[model samples]
Target: MFELILGLPLLGGMVVMGSGWGISAVMFALHAVTLLMSLQHRQSFYGSAAGIVTCLLFSVPVWGMFGHWITAALLLVSMVDRYGAGMPGSFRRS
Candidate 1:
């Protein structure tokens, strides 16, 4: 749920890179907060960390879009895996 919410800005940025630096700044802050929350919950933080990196490189046009795509993909995969592992009778590899 939170991952999906975080992904909205990334998708929006890809469509409109001209939204200015303010959006990127806000995203950076959001990612930072999310990272802290993930740490508190002991959940995976890779997606939020990647989001911070993406926000930092967001002014580079091409690289920014690429980063957004990669971050979004990472978030999606993490969300799926988190939920999958919680399912009953799911196989766990150690």
Candidate 2:
């Protein structure tokens, strides 16, 4: 399932780019991938929801790629916090 995060975005980017949206397609994939990964840990959904919105904005009035960094930052923080608990599937401390 983890691999799906990257694979899905690449698939989505290709489809969106086919419409001639170019760079916006990359932005869309960026947020979508982040949203998907974050949703996996079951922490919250709203952040991922926001990512989807950012993906949409990329297709419209959003003219810059910087906003994708926000999604990446959130993903980074969430992932760091997750691993701090120790690797997934490892035995937990009492």
Candidate 3:
């Protein structure tokens, strides 16, 4: 699930750079579709799915907002998915 969220953009960027304009457009379209699916999946995880839906809807308006730091943001999100321990455990010793 996390991979789909993160990989689409990364792959889209690669395809965009490696090929012609048509390829890029297709990749971008696929990315949007996949994002919609992920948002729906996130919604299923929680009774409230607005958070993911809201995020997916905001991508267009937020374009270029991250500029060069987009990669960093993606990396961070991916890291949290892979390494983050959902919530802090009270059983841990200080």
Candidate 4:
């Protein structure tokens, strides 16, 4: 759920990059919030971390689009990997 929310802006910002920097600013804030939430929940944060990087470099034309695509893919993978804490049978900290 959260991953999907985060991903939308990445893809959307690609199309709106010429409009202004507002989209990038919004994405940065969203990623920051996601990072904080992941820390509080002790969940995997690689996707959010990548998103922050993407936001930072998303003004570089070709490379920026690539970053958005890659980050969005990572977020999708993270969404499908909800049980990424550990192996299925292994004990996990609560």
TM-score of each: 0.69, 0.42, 0.34, 0.69
Residue pairs that clash (backbone atoms under 3 angstroms), model 3: none
For model 2, residues 9-77, the per-residue Cα lDDT tens digits are 455446445657654456557657766765685564454565566566554323323344455555555
Candidate 4 per-residue lDDT, tens place, 43-87, comes to: 778889988998886666556667777777777677557644466
Candidate 1 local lDDT, 1-94, one digit each (tens): 3323333555655544555556677778988998999899888889889989988766565566667777888877767666766679986533
* Model 1 clash tally, residue pairs: 0
Q: How accurate locally, in lDDT, is each candidate?
A: 0.71, 0.50, 0.40, 0.69
Pick the lDDT winner.
1
lDDT of 3 by residue, 17-59 (tens): 4664454344345545655665675522221132233234324
Candidates 2 and 4 compared: the better one by TM-score is 4
Which consecutive 10 residues in model 1 have the weakest lDDT in total?
A: 1-10
Ranking by lDDT: 1, 4, 2, 3
Q: Which 10-residue window in model 3 sums to the lowest lDDT?
A: 43-52
Name model 1 segments beyond 4 Å from true. 1-18, 85-94
Relative to the true structure, candidate 2 reaches a TM of: 0.42
Clashes in model 2: which pairs? Answer: none
Residue pairs with colliding backbones in model 4 are none
